[model samples]
Target: MENKHPYSELGYKIFFKIKPFLKKILRIKVVGVENIPLEGGCIIAANHRSHFDPPVINIVSPRPVIFLAKKELFEVPVLGWFIKKAGTIPVRRDSRDTAVIKKSISLLKEGFVIGIFPEGSRARPGEFRKPQPGVGYLIEKAKVPVIPVLIEGTDKVLPVNSKFPKLFKYNIDVIVGKPIKFEGISSYEHIAEKVMHEIRKLKGERHG
Candidate 1:
């Protein structure tokens, strides 16, 4: 069957082209990749520590992921062009944007995978920010499986205030946890907490 999902072939191609270079420059170790389902719509809810989080997840994902990016990134020049072409959805961080919610639901129905950082923004390394309710809303609305992921060591490569990454100097670890599906409960906050709990477990950290 012809693909109906909105994954950009050009984006996947670009990712593959740059994958080798990224790998050569940074030591990235991916664990429990099998936890990611091979097909269908799923949400990858992860912790964010650095700007590199998105690309790292995209590169390691078994399938193409449509990221929910902060709206500001979409206003930049070349970065904007790439993200738009890659079929990323822009979200305004200051409020709960219904338009983004609707768009995400529509995409999920079309069998697209979405990568979301529930913490909403980058937090200090080894610490997690409280997850936003949007993630739970998406899970409840779309009724898709969620995979909790923990990313480590990216902060060292690109610290919070640094503009450029320290090339070839850091080892990054991405740990993928088993999928969590909400069978009946629909409270957005509760669901978000559950997802965050799983991520914390993977990171070997206490719940926030």
Candidate 2:
């Protein structure tokens, strides 16, 4: 198999090394780490509320995650370089790009974890955006377990229009639900709905 995400190895290693500091700073509380399989390809579908969502999820995830980042992020000077080295896939929002889909499926088949925010972009804090069909398509084609993750407090950490992230003041919780499998479920939109439903359930539990 070709190593498309070559920087993942080094990038993840660095993340692991700094995890302690991040934990101390962010007060990240992660639940359901055991739900993630020890190996194999899987999809992690999470809600997006802040730009910090990706790194927060990445740090807590047991394996290196190949996230589908916005294409513009790859054009950023230093940040782009870092994300690319971290093996994030660049995607054009609101565009019908088959190449991105094919690459995701292929990566899943190769047993790499793919991280996705089905909302397609960050949602306003305390707001819910319906999951798009792209994630459903990937789940249907990959034939792998789909992990539903709910991240709370990131929106406050670095809210929309905020230039800097507030540190050491919020408790970020990452709740990873059981892996959901769909069989004979053909509707991509339906699959995306089911995934969001699970995420909402996680949200309920957090407050309940």
Candidate 3:
């Protein structure tokens, strides 16, 4: 695997050491660290339970992840600095940013793990919906492996719009399924649905 992300060269100690303690302090248990590949670039499609999802994923995994986040997140000053330094790319939610797409492809080609949340929105409790097509776009364009990750009990741990996180112990389950591969998808949407199905299977019936 080649290093495509600029942050790929940076150390993982900060994210690795901090996440587990934070999770333990906050009581977020990770069960699938072994599921994440130790090397090479692959697309990790995880269920979005909260704003905490990205940080949680990075904290638990030993390998560095280059996340494709929405452009709006870049506005926060200190956070924006760290994300930029982390080899994260921002995409405009409303319009297609050719530059963002190109950069994602380049990073994938360079063998950096890129994460795409297929839901395209935050997770809602008692409900699961079809995934958005952006994930397929990346998979098809990059021709990489798609790792299906199921995030359970995250919504309960940190529900959307809670204002602040609770200190109570809550289980955050991460179930990683087998990688999915596609050959010459007719379109990006097709690739996305195919990937979403694999994720759905892994995410069946979330329990806290």
Best by TM-score: 2
TM-scores for candidates 1 onward, in order: 0.90, 0.93, 0.85
Q: Rank the candidate models, highest lDDT first.
A: 2, 1, 3
1-208: candidate 2 lDDT, tens digit per residue: 6656635666677888998788778989988888988799999999999989988988888788889989998997887888888888889886867899898888888888899999998888878798999888878878899999999999999998887899988889899999987776769999999999998888766531
lDDT (CA) per prediction: 0.86, 0.87, 0.74
**Worst ten-residue run, lDDT, model 1?**
2-11
> Compared with the true structure, what per-residue lDDT tens digits does model 1 show for residues 22-53?
76678888888899999888899999999888
Candidate 1 lDDT (Cα, 0 to 1): 0.86
lDDT of 2: 0.87
Task: Write the residue-wise lDDT of candidate 3 on 78-185 in tens digits.
Answer: 778788777788888897677877888888777788887888888687455677676676677777777877777778777887756665767667767677878766
Please identify model 1 stretches exceeding 4 Å from their true place. 1-7, 17-21, 184-186, 205-208
- Report the error of model 2 at residue 79, Å: 1.6
> What alpha-carbon RMSD in Å does predicted model 1 have with respect to the real structure?
3.5
Better of 1 and 2 by TM-score: 2
- The reply for model 3, stretches above 4 Å from the true place, is 1-5, 8-11, 204-208
Positional deviation of 206 in candidate 2, in angstroms? 4.8
